[model samples]
Target: MIIGIDLGTTNSLVSVWRDGQVELIPNALGDMLTPSVVGLDADGAVLVGLAARERLITHPQLTAAVFKRYMGSDRKTLLGSQAFRPEELSALVLKSLKADAERYLGEPVEEAVITVPAYFSDAQRKATKIAGQLAGLKVERLVNEPTAAALAYGLHQSEPESRFLVFDLGGGTFDISILELFEGVMEVRASAGDNFLGGEDFSEALIDGFIAAVGKQHGLTDKTADPAVYQNLRKQAEQAKRALTGAPTATMTVLHAGEPLSWTLSDGDFLKLCEPLLKRLREPIEKALRDSRLKAIDLDQVVLAGGATRKPLVRKLVAKLFGRMPAMNLNPDEVVARGAAVMAGLKARDVALSEVVMTDVCPYSLGIEVSEQLGPGRFQPGFYLPIIERNSVVPISREQIVSTIVDNQPALHVSIFQGESRLVKDNIFLGELILPVPPRPAGQISVAVRFTYDVNGLLEAEMTVAETGEKHRLLIEDNPGVLSPEQIEERLAALAKLKIHPRELLPNATLLARADRLYQQLLGEQRQWLAQETARFQAVLESQDEALILPARTELKQFLDEIEGDGWL
Candidate 1:
């Protein structure tokens, strides 16, 4: 009745426990991995997986892919008459997998255990759960993708005790996790990552290189002016990138804007293109190791997962960095799904494997925004007490005890954040809680702000006033409207209404090129200013402030104009 699913960014896989073994369910195409893409038919129907991906080359505007990166955010995609949230888009893929399972078993599949990235935020995790619900699945548990991979690997090896590192590099995200095995427990010590960085960057790098090669071969300037041409070239570049991993050189030939374009890239040249991205990956790996206080050599085995890890250069770099070769004996693409099945077996009590208890640590710190006494008659706002330190094991709970600063303050506002920054403005405000206290003297009202992080990384905060015995809970379920099912639907509707015909609906090529240039020109301080201004713009947009909109728009327009005048755009 229950299946294990690895809902990955580029591809998805499904597996189930059967006859004391884990078996992966292949789709109708007889492939273990399904591309996480969706296509809209002329009849307003949805097609998922490989069939949808095949349509991307010609019908790019009608297809949506790589949407997993926007799971927690407000981003949506419009496909013909339908608008889809990241979750809704993802449900199409999940639903397709569900149908495949049903077809194979000749029974309805209604329940599942889905795996998510280890560094996914609370909102992202909740969004994934919502996707499952939308697909008519009773999600028994949301397991961390790395932890699931560890479970599968541990079960496969039948090892007694070992500490292993899971390095996951998918299409649009990367996560490095350190997990330890003690007795029958597989505990995660630490996790770190850049959610925006992954194989997509490598693909971009390859595209850029191909652009240069095409320009040189044809003596044409501004090859990027044609979106269709660029898209075709990008596809060729991706193929070449993959081929160069095993071959000494790879050739790409494509017709761009009615012109014949051809190029050959060597493995050394391909590695050079991705060198910067490979360097960026080291930060997360080093951070994870440092947070766990374990050396790279201390790890018993380093396991690689995700399709991107198939790159020979990535493996070589990882080996050189760790002074050891990674364990690649297991299939990289299927390991996570296999692990999910093992976890399903353990949870169902269907297997005799030792009780594999997993305790994962929080990737980010939790704190509250409060006023700090700076000097005489002066107060500055900053992050106050930290409720959960990074790398603290879960399903753990902690609370910060604080009091009101003003006398007879009937209510106190608690602003929660998740980041290591000392400044309140630098961190993300997860949400807020308002607590009522009994009328009392200054600093007399004792309020406990409790934070609990479960195994899935979902955060729950509760405020309890001791004197009045008043309690308030801030569960994701409680904030229905702000984070509502209907709101998600509305967002999807809005996105659907908006036209995304890349050739006709998007901004002019010149304007888009200018925006990209301006984005790149932003320096250290200017980058921060841009972020603040964008946040302000988003707030104004959310508030629907008609009077403030024009002024804010003008400010942003002027900023863009200045950057253009400075020859940046």
Candidate 2:
């Protein structure tokens, strides 16, 4: 069966349209949300979800998180002795989710509707699709995050005729979309966002404050940076952020270079620290409104989405700007996965959700690079001529005419890019093709460049000569990651060979990793007690006494839980 998945930056979730409603599938942890972290165990087995996430704090240099921010780039995350691309890590997450879905549904899941940020480039979207493929799932649609959230909000649940805005600030990406709904039609009028911004930035703000405190107390120098300290700070900062979501204040503490640093940040103080990042949010909001040709007052409703929206300051910013409180009934974290499930239902033509029609637009301009000839033989090759401007309806095609610059020009290099800049250098280069042309005067031999962008954000460019009917096309096809198909297959093989611990051992492994990690942070009596308890548990485990293992495991867990303290947050 086909399911819907939210391969999010911070956490990933899977859901399905069950009994005419969306049902979120929980993982082995019995949690609907799975942390988007990947790492290696002591045995070199791949660890995902909660186990991997806890590993991140204990083994900072050996784990990867927030890799979503580099989806389309050639950047790699080094973990263990191996290096992994963002898409590769994403595939591992997808594989884990697929396994969970299969176990929960009691059947094989071969297809899904995956969601991406509205502002994600073609390369990023392609990488998402490829990741799904690597997980052995057919990804037929790449839904925009904001659009998916709107669906989950069940906009059709409201008045048929309305204009609304979606503010989606997730872990690693931000997106603002303006949409209109009329008669059973939901149309996305404009979409904009900053991929580099999100909840992680807020955590970073807290991190900076705590780091500064530690720096002053310890005089810590770089090049001798402590991974454990950074990792612990990241966890503490994340917890402090959640605590301050609605509370007036929250406390964050960490140890660096034997110095214990702490900060009790008030909401006002936290907001002040995050001023710059919060300010960046307005640009996309204003841009989306401008692109939609609507005012904040024109919106019938303002919607808040993504885990970051849980932040009180973020909500306050929205109210201050729109002059109206945004919708908050739907759980921000679960909304996108639910909406994706609804889309899957729609794709399946489920009778319950068949009435509403959805439409989306391209998020960026599409065009080709051409040289504009200046008089006296000087020409500039970096000129960008757009064939399709951003926000144009999808499954749409547009053509731009180009003339040969010189007499008898042998070929026309059809270089395609996606961006809003007038200079080609500033745009993202998608691909290019060189097509031969007959010898003729520069202006006499012209060809039409056709750009087609589909609903899924798939793009194809073709160059055609009217007279000879000769054509050349550039198709990145569905592969947009830094790796080609051959490379992808090779990587897939490598991933398939990696060992992953049995599901039953995950809980034990995670707890052991956590305890072992804490061992590195403790001292004196606490350290000695933990060491003795860990050794006892290890002896029990190694003894292979099935009768005693269960109780010993519980005993060990209780011991750790008793000492977890406030730092457990």
Candidate 3:
């Protein structure tokens, strides 16, 4: 069986198309949402979802979160005793979701359709597919998150024709996609975003505000040396942020190094604090609108997706910018998963989705970087000439002509990149290829570099030598990582050796980790108190009092959360 997976930044979910409708598959906790976190327990077993997230607060040095932001990069996250690439961490999450889907369906799932941000680069998208492969699933399609949301929304709505803008601001990334829906067709016109901007950044803005205020009042330095203290304050501020979503006022309180610091922020004040982030959101929206050749009034609907869009300020900003309220009838968080399921159904050629056809655009420009001569011997090395522009419909082929730079040049180097910068140094280098050219004078031997992009986001670069009808095609592998295929295999073997606890023990393990973390964060009396609670919980867990364990775990966790003044989940 094949399932649709919304492997998100903050939380991930899986769904399946059954009975002509989409249904979400719940995890072991019986919740559809799984926290995108991974870590190791004291026993050296892998822990994921809530359990891992809880450890992130307690054992900040031993857990990893928000690795999704590093997708396609050479960056690695260090856990307690191992280092993992972002794709590997993502694979763990995908494995957890796959387990849930299998258990729910009572069947094996070998394939899936995953969703990514519309503006995700080719490298990032390919990294996602690799992550799926690591999780033991074949990933054939990657739908844009915003486009998936539109599918979920438009498929159910009564409207026969509509042009909408999808504003998706999730935990760690933002994407704005403009799409048109007409006669059972959903065509994505354009996409744009800043990968670093999202709800977590907003939370950081609040944390920064608190830290600045505390530093000024205490006459201390601007930065804290302790990461634990920073993470603790960040957690509290995040909870307070959620509280402030609908409420007018909220306070963030944390006890740090024997000092109790508290700050109350009003909606107006919070907005002021997030002025920079709010300003950043406008760029992608404007870019999407401009690329779609759309005016504010031309949009038939403004569909808001992602959990971050639930904020009142976000809604107000959209309303003010578009002169209309964005649709709120559907749950923003679940919209992408639902739409992904619809896509999965379409991929499977299910009769219900036979009429639905979708198309997507390239989110960035693709071109070759070459040296350009100014007048005489003066040459610039980073000139970029685009063969395919950004926001152009994909499954497309575009070509641009380039000539030999010197007389009787036998070989020419073709360096392909993806970006809008006029300087090639500023763009993302995809790969380099060498083409053999027949000896000819400068600007005489014309070579046409053809770039063909398919729905999978993979690129095929081909160079046709006009003089001899000689052609060379190279498939650029999207792995910009440090590992080769052999090294990845070795890494995979090593990773597979790690142990993972049974799913049923996740909640107990999570509470224990939380209590242990609290013990570490507090000092003196508070530490002793947390240690005692930890012992009590440990006793209850050892006793195997199945009925009593949950209540005790909940009570202990609630007590610690109450003491810390954090209600964030």
Candidate 4:
């Protein structure tokens, strides 16, 4: 039997299609959403979900979470004596979800439909597939989270003509989507988002505010210098932010340098700290709406997903902008999982499904890097050739035919990119394709570069030499820097044999101390400015009764950014 999984940044959930109904499989905590955290134990065993997150307060260095944000990058997370790729870390979470599904079904689960962000790059999507493989599940298909949410919402609506927008603000990523429902088909007209922004940013905002308050109270001017204290304060501030979302005020108490310090934070103060982060969300929302050529008023209903969307301010903003109250009937945390389960059932042939064809658009433009002629003879640096514009429908393919400029050129090279930037260097390079051509006149040798985007939004670049008919195809799996199946097995085997430090004595204390010292230095008008912003942030933070440590933390981090640039003191 197949199950659906929503592998989110802050939380993970599993669902299954059973008895003609969709049901979410709860974790051991009896909660639908499982924290996407993993920690190393003293005996070298791996712990996931809430158990792992509980260790973050004291074992921050040994725990790794939110690695989903770095899915396609070369960023290596050091958990102790062993290092883990983002995919590998994600696989652990997937494995846990698989276990939950198996336990609920009373059988072994083999296949799943995992949901990803609409704007996830091809590399990131491929990496997510690999993680599923490592977790011992066959990834039948990768669906966009917003698309899944739409399927869940549309299943209940009998409206013949319906149009709505989906605003997903999860723990670590945000996406805005405009979808149309017609003739039993839910089509995504356009989608856009900032993969790096989400509820996590809000939590950081609160952390920075608490750090600043601590600095002023103790007269310690150089709070920013202490990483360890700052880390601890950030943790505490995140807790306080979550508390404020439900209560009128939250008290934060921490012992720094052997002295007990306490601060009272009103809900108003929490929202003020997060106002800046809130502003960044507006651009993506506006872009998605504009790209679909639909005004805010055009949307009949707006659906909000991700745990972070529970923030009262986010809902208020959507209502004020769209002139309609957003729908929250479906579980914000479980909607994607439920939708994924329905998709999994469809794929498994277990349900009598409708054609319900879904057409999605590419979030970013695809192009090739090419050198352009500056004037008569001089050539400027290479720039990108945008073959597939952003928001173009798929599964689609486009061809860009060009000829070799040099005489008797034996081979043609094509460099691919995914971004809206006109400059090649500004776009992300998705690897290259080289095809051999017959030795012919420079201008006569033509090469056809075909770019095909599959239903999963992954790109396949194939080049054919028109004269010779020689061809070459490249898949992201061919890249070793990004792990393939064999590489994942090898790394998993090696990880099993490696020795790692115990969670009790990781360098989290030192990092937290450094973070604290750095947090104390901003004072005078700097503190006043942040305080005013925090007041505005609290107005939003206090309005929500849901648990929101993640968003508050993000807000605090933004406040810290106002005082210091990337250059950490």
Candidate 2: how large is its RMSD?
2.2
Q: Please identify which of the two predictions, 3 or 4, would achieve the higher lDDT against the true structure.
A: 3
Write the residue-wise lDDT of candidate 3 on 186-258 in tens digits: 9999999988998888888888888787745754344346666766777777787888986999887666656
Candidate 1: list runs displaced more than 4 Å. Answer: 215-227, 439-441, 477-483, 486-569
lDDT of 4: 0.76
Q: Give per-candidate clash totals.
A: 0, 0, 1, 64
lDDT of 2 by residue, 445-518 (tens): 88999988998998988889976998887775533446788887998899889887777677677778878877
Q: What's the lDDT of the predicted structure labeled candidate 3?
A: 0.85
- lDDT per residue for candidate 4 within 405-470, as digits (tens), equals 666888777878889888988888788877777788767988788888888878888888787787
**On a 0 to 100 scale, what is the lDDT of residue 302 in model 4?**
95
lDDT, residue 53, model 1: 62
**Per-residue accuracy of model 1 over 1-569 as CA lDDT, tens digit each:** 78999999889999998778889998865678888988764444566775566455555677788899988776768776556778888877887788778877789989899998877777788888878877778888888787888888877666788999998888888888899997888888888888888777787787778768776667545545654455555556667767776789988666554466677888989889888898999999999999999998899999998888989998998899888999886798899999888877876778565466766678888778887777774667665568998889888899888888777888898988877788878876678888878878878998888998887677889888888788899874432212487765664554344322232211122232333333433457766766666667657757766677657756765675765342210
Write down the lDDT of every candidate, Cα atoms only.
Answer: 0.76, 0.85, 0.85, 0.76
**Candidate 2 regions off by >4 Å?**
221-224, 477-481, 532-569
Please give the lDDT score at residue 301 for candidate 1.
92
